[model samples]
Target chain A: MKAVRTIAELREQIGEMKAASAKATIGLVPTMGYLHQGHASLIRAAKVKTDIVVVSIFVNPIQFGPGEDFETYPRDEARDLAAAEAAGADLVFLPSVDTMYPKPTKTKIAVSEVTSGLCGASRPGHFDGVTTVVGKLFHIVQPDYAFFGMKDAQQVAVIEQMVYDLNFNVTIVPCPIIREEDGLALSSRNVYLSPEERTQALVLSRSLRETKEAVKTGQIRTAGEAKELLTQIIGESPLAVIDYVEIANFPELSPLAAETAILEQEESVLMALAVKFGKTRLIDNCLIQPKGE
Target chain B: MKAVRTIAELREQIGEMKAASAKATIGLVPTMGYLHQGHASLIRAAKVKTDIVVVSIFVNPIQFGPGEDFETYPRDEARDLAAAEAAGADLVFLPSVDTMYPKPTKTKIAVSEVTSGLCGASRPGHFDGVTTVVGKLFHIVQPDYAFFGMKDAQQVAVIEQMVYDLNFNVTIVPCPIIREEDGLALSSRNVYLSPEERTQALVLSRSLRETKEAVKTGQIRTAGEAKELLTQIIGESPLAVIDYVEIANFPELSPLAAETAILEQEESVLMALAVKFGKTRLIDNCLIQPKGE
Candidate 1:
């Protein structure tokens, strides 16, 4: 395994690899370091699907807001390198901020509609930063396939649209959301939660699981009712403060009103939420594939 | 040269080309296809610099305004194919409008600053359209080098910024302006000019040349003075009506006051203009690199 710290070195290494094996299929797993089981899953999946797996770890500052956790974002390169290699990442690209952004960037890739709701509305300019870095990474790696965890469902949707819009050659493989046995979604930010706050965060996944069951059993008829139930569940935890509880049509993310009852013929819908447990903000979601579609 | 129309066919052909020669450097010359001497110059340049040249003939409708000439824009695949071949192109991509835009496109690639003045100000969303189509073409062709005629100086500037911002793995080569014996810049729209209007169109390039001379000789120190001189020269033609006459610092296109006289230490400036001869609009520009220290 190789660790490349510069774009030039990364490209050269990939180019040399291509020269060595012209038919090799390269896969990329892009992450912002502090590797957890979720990133390992993506890397392991890449290993199966591609001859070469490249994992990029860069804590992108552009994706964070003024008061966000960019300053306090975790970093442990030696640990990350070992974890990535163990998970079968053939090369680890660990680029510095200066290399990623050499100058004040003036070009922005904007996706509308899908980007307007969810985290897009809460943290302004967040998706753009994600798409920009992902786009840059895609070009640099020129991967045959790129793996993205479904934990960031909206991020996957935005990237799908960007790839379709820009006609990128790589295929985006969306992996299933990896969660703890206790139902908490795996995230680097999960480390930010204190012990008490960590237990309270369980409300997020519990609500989602309950809602998925209700949705399947037809107990929840409308998107509005689902939102109310989610809000109620998360609100009960004294440490939890709700940011948003949204139910939108799957993929398109079209908003559903309180009065917009779930249809008997509806196949799938998405339920997502964000809550602040102390200063640590966590997000989670689940897709409801209604029964008897 | 071979011509491929469908995106699938083009991609397949390019894939085969790569399979044959893994290290070949492809060059692209994107054009709207009334293939004038200007486009031929770009194609010729590509032939010299690249192992394979792909000239794309796409009359992008998105770049034209609602009442603009998109519907009536000139196209001739046979003539263009012949012209491109004559200029030593290896392949010609002649995608229909339907193929290029199969559905309503929601994504756009936008470049700022350099796209703010001159034609960008006169025609809203025009540069976005250019960048979008060119971006699509770049992805389809995956060229190592792309050529653009400097006749559309701001277009070149906008594309340069977009390529840089997006970190496209392509180098932009801005070719020199190709002109006629009477100094009229070669453009596909030149066909729209009536003989009398064509004669009057000389004022566009004439003023640009005169301004270049004035700036070089230090006779026009300030951007304002240069604009006045250009306006006066074009206004003298009874058939000419000015659209915009802008003098801005090169590349950046920053605003410079009319009273800010020329300085001995000045290195570069871009003087550009758009004028209407009857209903036909024509544009021309010159980049002045001042002599002496």
Candidate 2:
């Protein structure tokens, strides 16, 4: 496995790799460092699908809002490199902040409508940062397939929308959300949570699981009912401060009416949540398919 | 020469071309077809530099303002194909409006500061539309070098900024502005001018040429003096209506102070003009370098 820090070096390595094998396909797993099980899952999935698996580790500063964890976000290059190599990444792009952004970026890629809610609403300019960095990665890697985890559900949707709208010559392969045995979605930020707060974060996944079950059992037919169930379950945890409990049509991310029968809709429904446990804000979601498809 | 309409067919053809040649470089010339000398110049330039030269003729409607001539924009596919082929283009991608935009694009690529003045001030959402479409073309063609005519000087700057900020793996090649014997810059919109209006349009280029001569002769020292000279020369035409005659720093497109010494600045000075002859609007510019090395 090889690790590169500069774009020029990465391109040179990629060029050599391509020259070696005419039909080799590249897969990119973009991430912030301090790799968790979720990130490894993406890298491992890339290994299966592509001839060259590149894992990018950079805690993009622009994505964090003014008051957000830009300074304190986790970073462990050694651990991340080892985990990526173990998960079968052929190359690791570990660029410093300056290497990624020599100067402040004046260009921004914005996806509207879908980005107007959920995490986008709570944290402004966040999706713009994600799309811009991801765009840079896409150009730098020029991968055949770019893997993203559904753990950042809204991010996946926004990026997919950008790819579709921009005609980027790459495919977006969304991997499933990786979670702990107790059903808590794996996140690098989970390290930020206190032991007590860690336990409370599980309510996020539990509420989503129960809501999915409720929809399957025909108990929660309407978006309003699902929101209510989610709120009720999450409210039981004292440390869980709900930022948003949203039910939107999947992919399109348009809001469903409160009384709309979500189960009867043709599109898949996304039940998403954002809860603050102390200073750390964590999100999780589930996609519920329509009945009798 | 080959011509393709659908993106899928274009991609397939490009893939085959790449497979056949180990290190084939693609150069793209993006245009709204009415095959003027300017566009032909770009295609011919591409032929010299690249293994594959693709000329994309797209009349992107989104760039036109409400009162602008999007619907009335001239297109001659049969003529354009022949011109492109004659100019040494290997392929011409002539996608229909629907093929380029299946739906109204939700994604937008915006470059701030650089797009805030000049034509950007006159036409709202114009640069956004240009950048978005150009970005799409860059992705669709995946060219190693993308060419743009400096006739739209601000456009070249804006796209360069976008490419720099987004880290697009494409080099922007800004071709010299092609002009007629009378010094009128070539443009597809030249077809919209009436015979008298076309005659009056000579003032746009004439003023820019005179201004360049003035700067060279040490007659014009300040931006204000340059603008005054430009206005004086162009005002000689009775049918000409002055839209904007301004001087600014080149590439950056930042406004130069009226008192700023035109020939003393470290950066290249740009004297740009936009004049209307009856209902037709025309633009032209001249770039002046600083004092001798």
Predicted candidate 1 versus true structure: per-residue lDDT over B1-293, tens digit per residue: 78999989988888888889988899999998989888999999999999889999988989999889998888787888889999999989988888888876767787877788889899999998998888888878889999999988888888888888777899999999999999999999999999999998998888888877777777777778888999999988999988998877767787677776555326567788888887788888888765422
**Model 2 TM-score, all chains together:** 0.98
Q: lDDT score, residue A85, model 2?
A: 94
lDDT of 2 at B231: 95
Model 1 TM-score? 0.96
Model 2 alpha-carbon drift over 4 Å, by segment: none
The per-model DockQ list reads 0.72, 0.92
Query: What is the DockQ (computed on Cα atoms) for candidate 1?
Result: 0.72
lDDT of 1 at A112: 83
Give me the runs in candidate 1 sitting further than 4 Å from their true place. A259-267, A290-293, B259-267
lDDT of 2 by residue, A129-220 (tens): 99999999999999999999998889999999999999998999999999899999999999999999998889999999998998888877
Among these predictions, the greatest lDDT belongs to 2
Interface RMSD of each: 1.1, 0.5
**Residue B48: error of model 1 in Å?**
0.9
TM-score of each prediction: 0.96, 0.98
